[model samples]
Target: MKKPAKIWLWVALVLCVCTTGLNLSEGRWLSVAIAIVSIIGLCVLLFGQRKAGYIVMCVCAVGSFVVGVTQNMGELGAALAIVMSLIGSALVPVITGLFIKSQWKELK
Candidate 1:
């Protein structure tokens, strides 16, 4: 992978670990499980040899969308908070994966 792409992957790994830590601290077991899946997806993208890693990334994106949206649905009254949740929890990881797309030919 290109150096820039690798750096993005490392950022993703750190985010995943932080997410796991925060969820565990909050006693949100389900959130933690979802985070673990996301972590696995990032691992596949970082180290796996096949295009299947993209599939894993997409799955994680959708899962994150659902969980992030549902978890923050109650905060709809706070527009700023909702938008931040939508962007932060839902979009950042997908963007991170996009940053790693420089190596698509290698994976293919």
Candidate 2:
């Protein structure tokens, strides 16, 4: 991966940790597991598990998008904020995953 991709992956890692902490505090075991997968995914991605890394990153992005929308759906008046936030949160992992996926030939 290139420098920017690496940086984004690091950001994704931070987000994964935060996700774990937030879900743990809220007693959401499934989200916590998703976050754990993201953490491990990043590690494996860096260590040459490119295919698994892609799968994990994609899963994390989708998971965050689904969870965030479901949680924020009740805020009818804040629909714009909800969409923006969801996109923003999901982009880190999604973008990072796309970048890594594009570099499949270079990674291993």
Candidate 3:
């Protein structure tokens, strides 16, 4: 995968690990759900080859929406989830930019 894709994959992996660990430690309801959703996001990021990844991403998005609404989270939480969805969707390009900057710096 491209650098951007790899970055997003790395972020998703980190989020999954962190969220899972938090859930295990604190037993927070949202923690478990976040971990599951992030894990799904990671799977889509890494192995979503044949349009399956897109479908998975869509599922994740909807899942985020449901979580936001069902929990009755205020605007902040809902906005956060929306932002997270956007990040998950465009993570590859964001990561790619970082790589490019780093590479340019190295060259300089």
Using lDDT, give the best candidate's number.
2
On TM-score, the candidate that comes out on top is 1
Considering TM-score, which of the candidate structures 1 and 3 is the better prediction for this target?
A: 1
lDDT (tens digit, per residue) of candidate 3 on 15-80: 657756865686657646755765665565465532344345455546555654544446457667
Models, CA RMSD each: 2.4, 2.9, 7.9
Clashes of each: 0, 0, 1
Q: On a 0 to 100 scale, what is the lDDT of residue 91 in model 2?
A: 70
Segments in model 1 whose C-alpha atoms lie over 4 Å from true places: 76-82
RMSD of 1: 2.4
What's each prediction's TM-score? 0.77, 0.70, 0.48
- CA error at residue 51 for candidate 3, angstroms: 2.6
Question: Which regions of candidate 2 fall more than 4 Å away from where they truly are?
Answer: 75-85
2-34: candidate 2 lDDT, tens digit per residue: 777777777777877886798899987766776
Q: Per-residue lDDT for 1-108 in model 1, tens only?
A: 777776777787897799789879988777788778777777776777456765665666666656666776776645654576567666545676576566677885
